[model samples]
Target: MLRFIKFAKDALLAFPLTLIFLPFSRFFSFLYYYNKLVIWIWKNKGDVTYHDFYSPFRDYKKRYALYENILQEQKLKEESICYLEFGVASGASFKWWLEHNTNIDSHFYGFDTFEGLPEKWGSFDKGAMSYKIPEIDDSRAKFFKGLFQETLNPFIQSHEVNITSSARRIFHMDADLYSATIFSLSQLFPYLKKGDLIMFDEFSVAMHEFKAFDEFVSNFYIKLRPIAAVNNFYQICFIVE
Candidate 1:
């Protein structure tokens, strides 16, 4: 008799909540299936392990080579360029770009919380990738220590003239959450132009990076063409068309 009463009480509590959320659940279910169909029809399926979009280099460093080739082909090496990186945990990738771009006129900016993610990301909690901001040691490379939404606008406004004058813009997105990626993309949409390269570090995670990119492009009516990608789909680079 006690077990039956407990079951009844639990069902009674859940009944109203389920009624309140039923519409939302149905709407999300429709969106999920719609997005799946769209991706299946539109997404490119290239060689997962290697692609020679620009260079023949087919190793772990292929992505870097592809970036270099894009820069060269676009003649951005001789012009001022803007390199923006989101989620600069240890500043490793930011430093690599600074060292490799080798253009005195190029400017690099990195944005991160430095304390890690603001919310949970799959197996990672709120503070999963926290790290101390490393000294970039380069005058052209600067770090903004805060969330992207907080720091991006001010930084962009301050450097609006320089950024607009730059011949090429590159964006590296390492933020591993859907919300972060989508928000950063939306914020940066106005500054993006043809020939700009956007590299996603965690692109393969279907529910996060991929979903964010899909929504961003769809909402903005932006055209993106895949230029390079890793075998496991962990990283992918797309050029704004």
Candidate 2:
């Protein structure tokens, strides 16, 4: 029986699976993560999460409500937070934080291409959702006008001491593509600390943000406990526990 089991495992490993499955891998990967997402939500959506499970129509505006609640609950409005936003497309959320925080010591860093996505995302073509960098008068706000791959490291190197300071850290992951999301998270992993906040803007999209997030959590073995989920987990917030 042991010999047969070993033979079966060897046969499976030896099989030229990629030749047959590579074409449909995209679809299968999506299905697999979709199911994993559902399961994750069901298991983790405990009494703690500010959840709305049966949202009929997703209102992107609800993210503002989510922002409000998280800020209020965390008492972060007046705190000096290192606000790192990966996707600052129109700067709506960025401005929202700037308006609410009221902390002069708090620094806001926005990273983006300011042109559009580097690659195609879902139905949106490459370079879709393009916007000029928003102009702001605040000296506290700094914009990195390029891909995260190009900018984050240099920023980190320059601001290492300030970022790793006792100031609160809030990382807002609005980059919609899995590749971008995963890249940002993995790069940011080493700097993550307990009680730091992380958020996902397009979290319910299983094949993209969710897939990246799932893998990131699993890979890092990081302790991230979900605090709030709005729009049926489309926009979810977690704290590094």
Candidate 3:
């Protein structure tokens, strides 16, 4: 009985020690995995990568949040114009928007390379073009192919300047690279109105996206305030007046 008591006491004392070291152990494991992931990314930096435009396996919570935002926005207005998305992975978001956007006149305008991202995008890294885009069509949905700036400029200039311009926009930027994001932002800057929303897929990434957002804001002298930020730190939805 005494031996059992001593053993229990010793075990109880060691519990705190285990608790103290567990966090460090987990952190070290995270560091190891992070370093490995970086090495893998570096090794396959320019290699052809897959782009689904909309992967069904995306984080469900993120998708749900997107739907809730759209639904809430629709309830506030009858004819809320269009929901624009830059990287139409497999048209997942487009489908979500179409289903939830019961507002009769609302549309979804998705722009993509259709051939995946460019071979060499600016300086930081390259995007993958391994996945093929699937076919989707809706009367209200307009799909454009090619580089974002190349395709968007003419479309915006043509549709946005009319006296009866119903050309409002809510853009989602998910290109995940500095050059693509900046280029898209520059082209889209002119069309943005007071309540227009911009959701950046790669916002606040330590070195890649935060740098791009900062540079664009500074260079353009724009004030884009965050409206909603996801807990995962993967995306931020903003509005610019």
Candidate 4:
């Protein structure tokens, strides 16, 4: 059976048809992961107890609600927490959390290229969505300006103890690229604790953030229990279990 399967595979690739299919390999691959994404959602949607799934429209405002819902559920609004936000374009979400938490001891770190995305995301070019980092008045908040691949490791090393400290950890993964999202998750997986929170700004996008998330959870065997999902799962929050 194995021999037959191998022979069939080799014959397909050795044929002229392979050239035609090769050009559309990415298209075919997307269908596979898109189907996987839909199936996974179908099977696990019931497990997400606090979701506003299947909304008729997408509203960016619902992200704040997602944040509030999780905070109210976890009772961490005023708690001392370590908040790390990846892809802090314009710093809107970063400022929102910083203002909402009101905990002086809660350290907020925002990571981004500030110049724009490190790679192209769908229609957006490599430098699309580029914005200068917003200036915030709080001393508790700091911005790391560079690629996650370059900056994250150094930050992790310096704050290794603080990362695993008593303060609650909340990671806002707003990076829309799979490469950025996956790299950030993989790097932070070892530091993730049971109570830590992980939110994806683009969880429903099949090819990028969703792909990274599916791979991260599956590959690491990390049980991330969905807590809140808004904007048709465009913004989903999970708690490490």
Q: Assess the local accuracy of residue 240 in candidate 1 as a C-alpha lDDT between 0 and 100.
A: 90
Better of 2 and 3 by lDDT: 2
Regions more than 4 Å wrong, model 3: 1-60, 73-78, 119-133, 161-168
Q: Candidate 1: misplaced stretches above 4 Å?
A: 1-43, 46-79
lDDT of 2 by residue, 32-148 (tens): 999999999888888545878878988889999999999999999999988999999999999999888988999999999999999999999999889999999998899999999
Kindly report which residue stretches of model 2 are placed more than 4 angstroms away from their true locations once superposed: 1-18
C-alpha lDDT (0 to 100) for residue 72 of candidate 4:
89
Residue-pair clashes per candidate? 1, 0, 8, 0
The C-alpha TM-scores of every prediction are 0.76, 0.92, 0.65, 0.95
* Candidate ordering by TM-score (highest first): 4, 2, 1, 3
The residue-by-residue lDDT of candidate 3 on 157-191, one tens digit each, is 66564312564567788776667787888877766
Assess candidate 3 and give its lDDT. 0.63
- Taking the tens digit of each residue's C-alpha lDDT, what string does model 4 give over 105-181? 99999999999987889899899888998888999999999999999999999988878789999999999999999
Model 4 worst lDDT window (10 residues): 13-22
- Give the Cα lDDT of each candidate: 0.78, 0.92, 0.63, 0.91
- The model with the greater TM-score, 1 or 2, is 2
